[model samples]
Target: MDKHGNSYDKALDVFEKLLDEPLQKVLSGPLPLARAVGLATTSGYRAAAIAESEGLLSRSTEGDYLRGPSTRTIGLSALGFGEFALVAEPVLIQLRQATRLTAFLAVAGNSQCMIGPHSRGRGLTFAVPQAQYYLPSLPVLDDERLAEISLSNRHEAVAAQRAAIAAVSEREDRQCIVGVLLPGLHEAATDDLRAHLRKASDLLRTQSEKLT
Candidate 1:
């Protein structure tokens, strides 16, 4: 532990690594006791007991451990980026799982995109640093990049690149754009790619709309 008593922070890190489901859903999966014992100095049971007592983890009615109430709310208020990430997390996760690619939610600001929550697919994935303020503009080749940049700042992107589809959520807080990676989507004509991307983008828009 740090001199400032950051044990809770460490515990929070471990708990996040254990999650395999959306925070809004009840976790039906159970993590083995070994998962905690491997990290904490204490015994597995002791670690689990302490985590549960502190509300960092919850014990289900079936006696299995899952995400506690505190886990989802941990950093919701920490920063603007964090709040946006938390709100968009469930969508990004489901998108990655469904499409098998890297998924991210970002906001379009003056000539750039603000990165929010993101997830990786089964195939090779790339990452951007947290301090990155602008989004990377992937080149348009074959099934490579989505989102066409226009002179007016209208951001249009492909859902295939976005994986399970992504949309710009309609909200006053910020104009957010979502993107997903499309693996194995190669060697297609540009027109065909645009068609596919348009469909995917529409789907993502619909899904995000439902959430709002």
Candidate 2:
């Protein structure tokens, strides 16, 4: 079985793209492997296999793959309905509304930061994934600029991402990052947000110990 939940986001994207076709047809019959693959134009065989082993799909006696329990589980989880998301989304929303900035919640997984629930500020053009994870050159927690929320207004680098504080969540328990982008932050903040973002990594740890 595929133990790691890597590529789940991409695989799910492929799944959603194909849902209107084969998945609809398969409601009455077993979906052919090739047909399933054909529908997933962006996904590879390996990704399909991973989705299968993860319970997103199941091979029938005839070798056809069918939707399984994990599909719904993963879907709900992706939509921020899972235990971790449910607990974390509120905090993320609160932070965003409070700051009127882009607020995001990400969890640490596989040595990478797994993006989770998020809120967007007005005029925010970019988006972060709740499915994919980013492996920065250095850990978000290791950064020097954390715990100082006010610094973001100055250099935009130190105060911007503040990876140091977010890294705390990744320590012994729920390794998650909660970021709030200031209204004045510019496009450069994108790199900071993507490359080194932080906040509430410690809060997640304190609030949700079960997340680990």
| lDDT tens per residue, model 2, 40-63 | 433345555666667666655756
- Model 2 clashing residue pairs (backbone): 141-167, 151-159, 152-159, 169-175, 169-201, 170-175
TM-score of 2: 0.39
C-alpha RMSD of candidate 1:
9.5
Q: Which candidate comes out best when scored by TM-score?
A: 2
Misplaced by over 4 Å in model 1 are 1-40, 43-101, 110-112, 121-132, 135-167, 181-197
Candidate 1 residue-pair clash tally: 7
Candidates in order have lDDT scores of 0.47, 0.47
Stretches of candidate 2 off by over 4 Å are 1-83, 108-112, 124-134, 140-165, 171-174, 181-203, 210-212
Q: Each prediction's TM-score against the native?
A: 0.39, 0.39
- Whole-model lDDT, candidate 2? 0.47
Give lDDT: candidate 1, residue 11.
Answer: 61
Worst 10 residues of 2 by lDDT: 147-156
